[model samples]
Target: MRCQPERGHLVYIWTKNNQFCALCDEPSGVERDLCGPCEDELPWLHDQCSICALPLLVDGMACGECLQRPPAFTRVETPWRYDFPLDALVTRFKHQGKWPLGRLLADGLARHLLHAYGEGLPRPDCLLPVPLAKRRLRQRGFNQATLLARWLGAQLQLPVDEQLLRRTLETPPQQDLDAATRQRNLRKAFALSHQVELRGRHVALVDDVLTTGATTQSLARLLRKAGAARVDVYCLARTAKPGD
Candidate 1:
């Protein structure tokens, strides 16, 4: 396969002083190789619901809703709770097509997850980026989630397989809808496509952020239906549910 450059993945980074990292605005500090402000503003999920990944009280298990009706995915791992510098960075990457920002965030997530799950989290056989609808892909030029997933997969030593699952609907962006409405909108939005590769394999589904989780859940539902043994989600950030 040959690599083809496109509009979506043409992201660069800006230094702390706004010198010249075009697509991204990353700070430069000695520690952790991140800007000082960037280091502090990064939200770590110290305690959270095990299943849904919402920050929660100590020793929290699964959120009530998840317990009542479990999500299609077994677990989610995200270091930052969608906020602050992360929010700005993520938004810039998604809407502005800053692909470098996506890569930086994905690297941070891969590191955090390796520690959080220890050896408990099984290494996925391959990575499946939550696909974008064809129209969106045409408009955006690149799938931000795909950009992050590819970089993250390389960092984690996992193969990236973009063809395993797909989005069927040009569903309204989840950020535009309420929780219930978001879930409703995403219903049946994904379908399984690759059979020979996905059957009985474990998959790590990647996305830029996990909001209402409708998108990730939808993908997981389809992958599992296609014979995947397990599905785990890895997003750069996760929004802590209301009242969490």
Candidate 2:
């Protein structure tokens, strides 16, 4: 079942050159809706697993799980850790349909990806959003992943293939399941639409957040088996290990 939006949800609209900070509501002093200080205070992921982007104590190290079982995706790029005001912001956007907040975060993610590309990160040929189940899509009235992908595509000048991949199963909410159960729940949950040829092309999966990673892992494995040259994940934030 879906959760209700928090009482602290903020309502704002996007502007081209001027906007108020979504967090503090002060003049952002930038193109985006987040002020410099609030952006700095965000739970930025510094040192993390190179592949999964799981937060870590040191840099350039893989988490124990990834070392044992590597994910099919090449790497994950995210801007913040799932905590505090970020959690609230994401909840508002996803649950309450506050698209402007989603836009704010998507813009931040686009900037992050731009910096990464500047630092030699390989850009994918297209962006694919992690599809939501039909039932859930109706309930929520939108797919956050699709919105992020479109926004990022516009910002980065990449094509977004919304029909390239799809969710074929309606599983329980992943947040309610354990890691192992999450993986099990996703079995055969996704399949390629084959509307576009992905052969030899690199693609990035867009989503609002990555938790146990089972969803992306499942989708990545499918893409790899279908002859995709590479797969990557781009999201607004990565959650710490359960109970961390």
Candidate 1 Cα lDDT to native: 0.77
Candidate 2, 186-240: lDDT as tens digits: 9999998865577898999999999999999999999998889899999999999
Clashes of each: 6, 0
- Candidate 1's displacement at residue 239, Å, is 0.6
C-alpha lDDT of all candidate models, in order: 0.77, 0.92
Q: Model 1 off-target regions past 4 Å?
A: 1-27, 30-33, 117-119
- Measured by C-alpha RMSD in angstroms, how accurate is candidate 1? 7.1
Candidate number with greatest lDDT: 2
Q: What is the TM-score of each predicted model, taking all chains together? A: 0.83, 0.90
Report the C-alpha displacement of residue 34, candidate 2, in angstroms.
1.8
Candidate 1, residues 1-244: lDDT per residue as tens digits? 7476576674553343333332234535342345655566577667888888877776457778798889989888888888776788788788888666676677788887677658577788888898898998999899887888788877788899887677777887667677789879888888877556567788888888888888887778877877888899988888876665
